[model samples]
Target chain A: MEQKSNKSLWWVVGLVVVVIAIYFAATGSPNPSSVAGKTVKIGFVAPLSGDAAVLGQEMQKIALYRVKQINEAAGENGTKFEVVYEDGKCAGNDAVNAFQKLTSIDGVKFIIGGLCSSETMSMAPLADQSQVLVLSPGSSNPKIEGIGKYTLSLSYSDKKTGEDLAKALSSYKKVAVITEQNEYNIGIRDTFLEDIKNYPSVSVVANETFPKGTSDFRSTLEKVRQASPDAVLLNPNPGVTAENLIRQLAEMKAWTGYKLFGQLAYLLDSGRAPAGNFTEGMIVIDAPNVNSPELLAIEEAINKDQGGTLNDLGHYYTASTLDAVDLITSLITKDGNDAEKVLNDLSRGRFKGHIGDIAFDGHNFVRITLSGKYLIQNGKAVLQSEQ
Target chain B: MVQILIYSFVMGTQVLLLALALFLVYSVSKVQNFALGAIGAGIAYALYFSISAHLQIVWTILLTIGVSVVLGIINFLLNERLTRKQEHLFALLTSFSFAIVLESLISIVFGTDGKNIIPGILPVYEFGVFQIPIPGLITICFGVMIAVLLFFFVHFTPWGRMLRAIAENSFSAESSGVDSKKVRFLVYIVGSFIAGAIGILAGLNTALTPTMGFQLIIMAFIAFLVGGVSDIRGTVIASYLVVLIPETIIGSLEGVSLNWKMVLVFAVASILLGLRPNGLFVRESRKS
Candidate 1:
């Protein structure tokens, strides 16, 4: 009886293998191009549904619109572009899985996104190994600099903004810093602290850090307020976390008598400003919202079909994302859709984009560090000046 | 220092309220209502909708409480049906599943982005060196009132005595003609209402996230365990100790990381429990 059972088990195992083999044979290997045509398929990873879904979905919309526009105005080469989207959920592990699925199953060479810094960084190692090009529209963590040869970001690093903010706010004698414990926010916090140290007058009165997903920060803010800092730096990623910091600061009654300073995340949207009057006159330092006539035309085109302006969700991100796509497509156009050749060309090329004249240094770091000073006036973000 | 104490009191009240709410259900049902936080999150979302719909604060509060009562009744019915055999672990699992479902439902309705019911800088009233926000003051007052009311209700009221009787021995309470099921259902409604109130207070203090109540509930559970899990007074006291010590002493330190707050909580709990394995508050007679 035992011998018969062993033989049956072996037969079952063999049958399962045969079934899987037959299924794969019948369904053929995964293909990048959804359709049979001369198409350059690009895998797009974005947080479709999660904490950062609003921003990610908006990025997806812009990417799709860009793809559609490219297809509509197919160049002389007749190279049609296709974007296959996978949800990264604005998380690390999810992005790794998405990256694996895109490269292994979808078989795409070029990819766009991993909008969040963590998502982008998680996939950097894999992308670097696979020699896949990852051009991010949103990741701004200082650590992402020289992460990989194929890894490049359209957004300016937080290191530059943090140092700029430190110098900008150095006039204040005392400053309190509240930061999120994420790679991106931590990068800003650390850089800001390092630069602020150079100014003897600017003593950091309180430096508080909250874990990611922590919305209740009243106590932390209370402690910060107790220090009576002349200025406060609230650094967190845009979306819920930033909004919470702003709102909680208001609730702690810590908004009065202190200069509120923020970074690029705060510049994403003014609707996120604490409603009524708390955020009035607050200053945020970010990349210049460089919009040209051509950029405005693209925005108009996008708004026509997207039912809203791309800047409604994210201003810099939209411009940078457009730049990312344009850069990739331009590089692909010049280099014949080869990922390695595109990287080589991008390393040596200076491209003009919607965000302005964009160029990468030898290490593929964006060189145009033009920071803009945005003031919250009338509950809206307006560019006050170029810093 | 006064500000740190104010912070502790305000934050501790939130934890205490949640602990008391959990204690109410646990004492009666011997089942940990893991959905306590989800129920609160649901109410917070309700408050968010009401505020978005331009409802007045008074109306929003009423609407939230009403929604919470409905949710409580649903929970009571579900728990009654699920644990008809009084299987504690099965009931806990059912509650956990219910929590996940409710949390998902909240996420679907509210989206994952956090929202503030009160979206502005709150005015602070200063009395000498002590500065207190209106919401924090309100939370403290409400917390005190609720604590006093709970103390009186559990000790003096006939229904409270019935609840205690059921907690001690449900079979004996039922033999004495006490409607244990009815009393348990009422406890659920009250506990859930308090949880909803805490949820709104928390929202008013900060912002509303689908998982906002998750940390609060975890802290409450820790308080329950540390406080002997069977003593009402001990749970109340433990909630404040667990929150205040870590938040004020550890969190307010200049260089100490906020990550250590949880570590400190567990360390303190371990120390106290190691000294008294049963619990900090368990009576010697009960152990025997």
Candidate 2:
């Protein structure tokens, strides 16, 4: 019995030693929690392996490019940066886990990430309590504005987009709205409904909402088809869910001579391509048009690191990511590593970015780059210069 | 009304194919076969990869079927011992864990994005006011043919009798010299093949995601439960009911959306089961 106990004790000790070794090996650093002077460790949370990974991955590449430029400008003896990446999977639970790991385990005071609104919203309460400065590159939900004092977004809110969409749709006599029950979608939805009241001639024929992860929309589509609306607004989040919605809607070859309006989902070719020509001439309401030759050149240059498919979605997100890196790093450089102080100065600071000018109002959302409308032509949402 | 029927049947046939696979596996193993969903998803990835590789159509079909057989064998190996020992709860857990493992592995290999089997707009067949895509038509014909053939096999053939006998009483059937192990293995392989074929068709009809199998299997589970687990024909009826009830209710109602669809389906199924506990087609005798 004594010998058996001894053997089990040795096994436990061996397992612990192996776990410690793996911890050191995986982190690939000497004491990951400790950052030497002149080196800034920033935590990055993004959907590196889910339906929305394309967007997150592109933001990551742009972020890395910006970091490289900053570090090179800083020189070898100057303040260098290291980013610790965690996969948020575009879900709330996973984002919370990533945030906890980055804050508690990796010991990061600054986090740049969580491109999806769901990811950013989930990590807000924790960041507020922990005093970790979280700067989201592209989370656009209006609810994100007041979520936390420490949390801030480079992307503009969906509130402006919602009103912009209503104004664009004011000419239509009838409109049907189909929205996904998600934070970002709901933000736009509530605002759009409220603003649609301004258009007395435009009446909503059918108002529908579906839960997330719902792939089959045959019944919803059929019912929407029956409503005989002049315009149908497809409001699903960008990813597999959006693709599924448009694909199913296309499969039911009934909607002809009807206008299709969407948000981020239809604005990206990857999300709308599954619907084929069915989405042609559709109008997409999303971030402002940042398709200048200068922006396009930067987009192509940054996307080269990601096999050049990163811009398949759009270039506005790239601009936002560059501005986020610039804003956060500059704040940290001017102000010390104090997260609260950095966050405070960040709200007041304004700088020129790829999207032109960047500034934040009392609300944490960036006040620059209002939403724009695009007309889908030849399977792409071209910027409607008129809008 | 005709349009609703067309839509329901188009969706129903795919669910029927999935439910039939579930029923076939349950008839032999006496387990819920939760892994059926992941297996379908794995095969979907296989088809996507094959298409991406630009393989010949015949080779792609054969490779997909071949992957299905291999997946079936792996599933059988994972659960065979527990099932033989009659540890059904453990076997069910094993199958469930297998599903998780397969889903995680696929997500790691292929990522969780949706992929299209046929990337362009599919041609639609118009019957008056109803429009059914080519894939939907193929699913209907193939699903109906498979269902009829399976019905004949389960009701008329000797192998199906062995399956029924084993399902009814495995020990007794084994004592009567029935090789229950071989029959179960064969059933699992066949069931997986059916799942893989149906998975390809379903992906072609819509889009392929790692979680699609779980969504499909849920409908199949509801169908098989509402009908009779032991009766395939009953499952067929229940499949259509599960889809049509919600489709009809949500379609006709002015304010109702698709969110209420699952609620309406469950309510109707509960009411149906309350009336006929044995199932829609199952006729159980009550002894005085």
Candidate 3:
């Protein structure tokens, strides 16, 4: 009786181990849905509620609109494209959580967005480990390019934006620089300084670094005003610094003859400063505007379909998401359920996108023209003459 | 130097808020309420929404405090139910879980996007080389006021003495006809409310993000650990010292990244914790 019981127990344990092994084998790897008739899931992650929520919501809206349009135009193998929204919150740990959730719960074949660079940085390692394809819509940090073979950025580097700004301001003799001391701001400042080194005629009159979320600018502005440069280049986000700095500059009567230039950080439309008049005559280097004929058509169609106009920043995210969907669909059509094949196809081809043309180099870095300088005139941002 | 001082003060205010919450709960319940961070974050979210909807700051602050009180009461009741006969570890786990739930709830409601409280800058007051913002000054004032009130309540009030008794020996206080459970609930509510109000102040000073509370909580924990978790004065002083040391050093370290400073802080804290397990100001055990 004891021998029989021992044999029965061994058999049960063996059966359980086999079942567990089978489960792990079936679920551990990335498996594409039925390529013939099932709905294709495209995952999107963004900061939807914290300090960056406004931008994230805008991105989500645009992405959803684009997915709707894609599904309407060409049903992928008689299947519709569905977007699964994941909240990244633009933080490291949160981005990882969102990535895991999307990969596990939604079973997304392709993913778009990881809006902030920090978030992209955090998700990159996991994406590589999971063999998941991720295309960042607005992650411009140079560090992201080295993350993995599957990660790609639609946005250009800070270096490119800085170079564009330097070219735009080549005619100016003296320039003052004010930048926040955060990574993003520092990246732009360092790039701008490096690029400006090439211009012998321009002198950096004053340079000041302030903390991120700094609420007051009078002292910094006073220091900059004392230097009395022909132009002031600020690398802080437009939220508080731009509004207050501009207002203070106007109050100090420093805006009369001086030109103000900023990076894409000053592109937010707070509706407080209408037409960027306080910022008028200001030059900024940013992602290409969605005001072109093709973009306008797409925006119009999106608004008609979604019942609202996409914000300026939202358009870029929308374009990136659409491009990502197109790339993924094309890949899956060519080779079903093979992550390697999909990655190879994405790396090998050049795709035309709403933002511009996109082609990945041998290093898996997507080469895209995302740097352009625009002039803020009478509260409107117009492409610079050179651009 | 002035900028660093101002930033330090602002950072100190957040630290004090967290320290005070920890102090209050530890003094009355003999259990550290780790949910202080969640309370603060929830209040911040409430304040942000209220301000965005065109409500006055005063009213927003009031609403935030109210929400925090509600959360604290719920936490107390739930903790009481779960930890009635369990070990201290159970209470700690329960509070930790509560914090997670609150954080996740905020995430679900607010979405993952970080919202800036207000996008405009406060005008700076310049006094030669000494420059500061009116908002930063207000935060300092708020911190001081809360600390003063807390001091008076703990030292002068009869209820405070009863709370002290309960913290010293819950069974003895209960045998003396004091309702230890009620005192625990009151302490939690008051502590959480203070944390919540400070959260609003923090949101005003910087930007409001869901995870902003996480950093502040760590700083607060450090302050509590350094100052002696049982002593309010010690905690407050430790909070300011912790913030000031880092700010002063980081300001002096030109071209050395902030990440290096954070690493240094962690290393120092690990050493300090090793040397002084009960913190700088160890509380005397009455029964012993």
Candidate 4:
């Protein structure tokens, strides 16, 4: 009996030790030399391989290019940067897992990314607790404004886009709206409805909400068609959902006679939506980069190197991502790895970005001084008016 | 109201195709084939691949239907092998695992970004107050034809009567010279073939996503349960009721949200099932 007990005790001890070793191995720390003043490790979380991969890939390419240029121009005492790319997959749970891996395993204090709103929102609480600075290039959900002091965005909030969309559709007395259920889209929808209420002349006749990844809008479109609204507002993330909605609307014959209005996602120009009568005459409200000659030239050069046009979807996002890299690099150079100080410096500093003067308000949202209501004519986005 | 009815018919037909396919397998094999959706999705992806290669639409669909038959045979063979080992739980899980594997393979080959099977917009047919897309109209017609053919085959044909015999008592049917294995195999093939047709119609109307069929199966099961799991005919009737009433209600009401359509479906199914545990249309004395 004594010998049997001893054997079981030995097995238990071995199993515990094995488990401990596995845990440490799975979450092992980065090499100390990588962050010991030799390099600035910036953690990145983006949808690298999923449905939203096109935007993430573009952001990645632009960030890397900007980093290379910055590092090449730096003198002695300038820190070389290393970006640890984690695939967020544009979902909340995946973003949290990626965030934990970067902060705990990589020990990265400064992070850039979470291109999608769901990605950033999931990482916000953790970033706040760890005092890690998170500067997102594309998350525009208004709810993100209060996530954390450490959380900031380089793009304008969805509030502005929603208001702009409402104003553009004010001429139509009765309008139908189909919105995807996502943090960013929900924010845009709430604000758009709120703003549209200001114009009593406009009344929303039909409103429908579908879950993310929904492709069939036939029944919903039928509902909208039954209402015979003057216009239709389609708020879908830029990709398959948007294209499917447009194609199906055309199928239902609901595409005709309805003035189409969309948020910035439509302006990505991803080629997912075919260039024809369906896309023609559609008006999109997005941040303006039409007046930025210098940035446009840089984007042209990058596209040449990329061997593909990367800025088909709003070039403003690519520009913002590059600016984020530049801003982080400069902040680190000035404040040396202190996340709080770097964030403070970022808030105080003003810089000229591709989309015009880049400055954040007290809540860390970028202020938009330039925007455009673009007209889709002959498959190309033409600037109709600048605001 | 006419527009709502037309839209309901189109949408309900789409659901019925999947439900009846599930019903066919369940009645004979006593196995809830979760992979039915994945089988259809895989064939749809094949159709997309063929179209992308510039094949004619007719050739693409025919080729994909061929692929569906092969997949159905493989699924049934695997179930048969597993059942022989008395691994009922494993057989059931195999259906789910098969679906995941198929979806993963699709994601790898076609990519996570969804594809539009049709190259361009399809025109709509308008008559009086009703407007229906060409694809939607075709789907309704195909749905009716398949349902009628299935109903007649099950009620009047010898092979189908043997299938019913196997469903009632497999051991007795086997002893009476009914080839139970052959009947099950045929059921899977026919079911999967119809699944393939529905998949192509759905892909044409909406778009193709790796996870497209997952939600569809949920809706199909809801119809299955509501119509009485054992009665394919009842399930077919319930499918239209399940999709149409809620959709039309949500479509016509000004303030009602589209998201509630599923909720209404779930609620209707729950109420019907609670009142009739054997199924709203299922006779307690029926064998299946």
Candidate 5:
């Protein structure tokens, strides 16, 4: 009788455990197939907060503006678009969460953005596995092309930017390279180095990589000053390192003699740039200016109809978001209810975008000819004379 | 090299504040307060808002300390109520939960945007090879002053003696008419206030963010663990060593990255911890 009672108690406990587990599993897990409507939902993931929040916020604002314009233009049949903005936060775990949430909870068929290259790289695998058409607006790292065929970028690749920079500095016989020892910085530096190799006259006199978030660049500056190259290539993005490097270079009087060549990271807002003549002669490679007359006209029309300025640099992100929306609309317009067909169309088609015409290679690499190298003159970034 | 040393001194002020907090809690209450980092982050956010709005720095620092003290008191009360009968592990879990709560609250309130504090004080000195920002130098001097004040308070005061007694034997201290609970509460409050001050100093030195505490917490933990948690002098020495040694070693490496340098620190710390569970300076007793 005792043994029978014990077995009954165990059975009850097991049933309770199973019921609780089932309840949690059902409630906690998201349903991914619930999205179906006239309005196509596109997910936007970017680092909306943290150290890179400024850039992320700009991207978010731009992306939202684009979606509003598209929805308004549909004028009842323009294929109404729904956008879900998720904060990637520029961290691996957060990127994964953003990807998972967009895919599962939102059931977004397409995703745009992921501002930082780091976040994009982290989200690439999840995007590839889920077969979601992932488009990055600001991620410029070349390694992103290797992630999968589903990943596409609106920005110029590191290699292309490097080659452009190399061409810009081709006249200089001796050059010094100082970059942060991170994947992104190293990628740009390596690409630039390789491109410069083609020009035998340009020999890298000094190659140095400093720690990111470093406050003092005196030692690094001293080394570069000693090398006394015709030009110095700085590949660190805008933050503590960039600020410190510029300050140290100015302090050491290296700015007077050597030309400064930097990556896109150096083209910071007016406030972050150094004071006086520190940035006058520096050149940087960045995305093509979308503020051109042709682009501005389109932006003005969009703003007139949609009530937001396309002149806003952040609107570039919105343009990228719209690209995703357009891709989805085109897909559905062609073959409704066929996700496979939509993915295949995206994989095969070439679309003219805000940056430029974008088409994916078989390796999932998006080729865009929007890369332009600019020089800083009087605190303004102007396209290089050659360009 | 002078610039590196100066930067290390500025960095050390922040580390010293964290070390002092950890030292107070461990030496007086026989507990580790993981919530120090969260408190620091919270205080930083508060100071950022105050400074941006053009409020007085004095008022801001006071408010930050007041809020931190309240949080510490609440933490103590919760630990007393929830885990008084439990072991050290349970106390640690309680502190960890409080830290998480503080972090999440900051995230919810601030929304995770990093705020850059415009330093009120400007750079006062610029040598040929180095420049010293007045605010950072002030922070270092302030740390030294606080350390001296804390030393005197702990060694020369009656409350300090009572705190020592409680730390040595809470039951004995309670039996001898010293209110152990009161001492514990006070220690927590003081410790949190120190953390708040450190947070403000860090904000002045660098940008403030919700997750900044995570990085500071690791450095603080290393400083405290290496210093011998219960020894103040040891912690101060360890703080400088922790910052300068890794920085120099990492600086010396030709191609090895900062990420790898961090890994090396963690590896070394792990080995040290394995050999000396009580820390390098403090000896662990076999009997509780």
Candidate 6:
């Protein structure tokens, strides 16, 4: 009985080896191109949890929705795409691990995300080392401009938003700054401070940095108010913290003299809703609204699936993530799962999608950007001008 | 300076409420019920939603109490199981795990976004250079009331003595016919109620967060160690010390921002602990 069981096991092992050998021989490679009617696995890394979870969840929904659209459009016998998601937690260390696992273990040649700047910057080295192409949909850290050959960001640089914001505040003599001590906020703050130097009339009277999760910023607001600035730049992480700061600052009736300015975070209606009308008239400098009939229609579908990501996270991220998915899937549909070709085409090609006609143009990051001026008018953000 | 001082005390009161919650459970169970923060957060969310549903204030308060009691019962069971075996570390771990689970549930239910129990700009009263929000004033009043009441209860009342006796030595207290099991259960119930009230106040004061209790619990624990863990009086003083010291240091310094606030507080705590290992007011036991 033991001898018969051993013979049966050997037969099964031999049959598995033969099947795998035949599969490789028939496909001529371990992973066949999309053109050959094979499934392509794409890795997605995003916050998925932590403070930036809303953004990450929205990005994930967008990716999954877009992939589903592509798969549906592809039809039977066409190349199907599968997305393997890993929670980056919006931290550098966590992103590196996610990137490593995706590249080494999952054998994913292409990955989208590390939406937060820290995630993108940290994964750049590993992505380059593993020869995997990383396309970031939402990271805007100016430092990410030339992160790596394999890493490319579709999102606008903080340098553009900062300079635009500084230019917007050029009329003010005394500007107070309250920056959240995080990668994304730090990037915007440093850039804004540097650009504000261009205007000799402006002087940052109060520059304060608060740690993440500092809910009680009443003292921070009081300190900033004491500076007596004509304009105050509220540079904090988006969502809850930003809403908290705006509300706390607005609570002091006497602290209403200064004009409030924010970055991409101000574009979010959900973030500002808690403070009610407090955030009205606040100027925001970031990506201009990425509106297109095609994207708008897709966003509606995604909102149905994710409940309210498009409305909660707003347009910039949703548009960028949609464009990212379109960019990669198009590249996969054309050149197959070749990371080298994808990187090359991504850098040089002017791919038209949700965020308009854009490309990297031989640069590590995209050359085209929609960073512009926006104002909160009557409890809703309106694009004032496309800079 | 006045405004900074006002805000510091406001934050100090929040830490004090959390410390008292910790002290209540620690007194009898001899285990750090870290879930007190999550319990506070969970109950706060419960109250906020109940109020949002347009329930009457009385019903909302009653619902909040019911939720708090249920949460307290769950927390009691979690600690009671391990604490009976005198597994203090395991009890702490179990409570910590419960804290994580509760926070995750809150996040799942409410999302990570901050919700305002009272939306828009809060009303504030001016006292010369200091502008104090109504909630802050209320918090300060309540903090003092609870601290004074707790101090009196533990030092003067029979029930308080029973609680303290169990805190010192549960086995001996039990041997002396103290009904320690019942007392510990009662302490957990009271502790959960306190946690729930603090949660509501904190949610009203600061933007409600899923991890609000987690942050408060850490601060309370530090104060618990800094003040003597054996007594509520020590915890009260240490809460003010831990909160005020960092606020003052950050306010006074030019380069040091609120980013370094926690680091400074931790350093100050380390130094304080170094000076008094058993805590500020806890004296060394004389073995004669």
User: Candidate 3 deviates by what RMSD?
Assistant: 11.0
The DockQ of each candidate is 0.35, 0.42, 0.10, 0.38, 0.10, 0.54
What's the TM-score of every candidate structure? 0.87, 0.91, 0.76, 0.88, 0.82, 0.92
Q: Write the per-residue lDDT of candidate 1 for residues B1-288, one digit (tens) a residue.
A: 667777778888988899899999998998888888888888988988997999998998789878999989988887886555788898888888888898888888888777777766666677776677777889999998998899899999987899899999988999999988888899899989988888888877777888888878988888888887678888888888888888776545887656567888888777777776666677655533
Residue B251 local lDDT, model 4: 74
RMSD of each: 10.6, 11.3, 11.0, 10.9, 12.5, 7.5
B24-92 per-residue lDDT for model 4 (tens digits): 887777777888888888899998899789889788767887799888997898788765465767887
Write the residue-wise lDDT of candidate 2 on B31-117 in tens digits.
Answer: 888888889888988989999999999998888888999999999998899888888899988988998898888888887787888
Candidate 6: stretches off by over 4 Å:
A1-35, A304-309, B56-58, B284-288
**Candidate 6 lDDT over residue span B1-288, tens digit each:** 778989999889989998998988998998988999999999999998997899998998789889988999999998897888999999999999999999999989988778888887888879875688888888899989989998999899999999989988889999999998898888888899888878888888977889999999899899998998886778998999999998988887766789998898899899888888787888876879
Look at candidate 1 and tell me the lDDT of residue B10: 85
Among these predicted structures, which one has the highest TM-score?
6
Query: How well is each residue in A1-387 modelled by candidate 1, as lDDT tens digits?
Result: 999999999999999999999998999755443332367879899888766777887888788888888777875556678788998987889999999999999888888988888889999999889999998888888888888888888878888888888987899999988888877788888999999999998899898887777766766777787788999988877777787678667655424788988876677663356645777788988776676777777777877877765654556678888888878876675566578888888877788777777778655457767777889887777888875
lDDT, residue B87, model 5? 61
Is candidate 2 or 6 superior in lDDT?
6
List clashing residue pairs in candidate 1: none
Stretches of candidate 1 exceeding 4 Å from the true structure = A1-41, A49-51, A75-82, A87-89, A104-107, A251-257, A309-314, A329-338, A378-387, B55-66, B285-288
Colliding pairs, model 6: none
Q: Could you tell me the lDDT of residue B173 within candidate 2?
A: 95
TM-score of 4: 0.88
Categorize the docking of model 6.
Answer: medium
Candidate 5 wrong stretches, greater than 4 Å: A1-37, A75-78, A167-183, A196-233, A237-259, A270-278, A297-318, A361-363, A385-387, B56-62, B119-124, B267-278, B283-288
Looking at model 2, residue A205 earns an lDDT score of 92
Sorting all predicted structures by DockQ, with the top scorer first, yields 6, 2, 4, 1, 3, 5
Single out the weakest 10-residue window by summed lDDT for candidate 4 chain B. Answer: B80-89
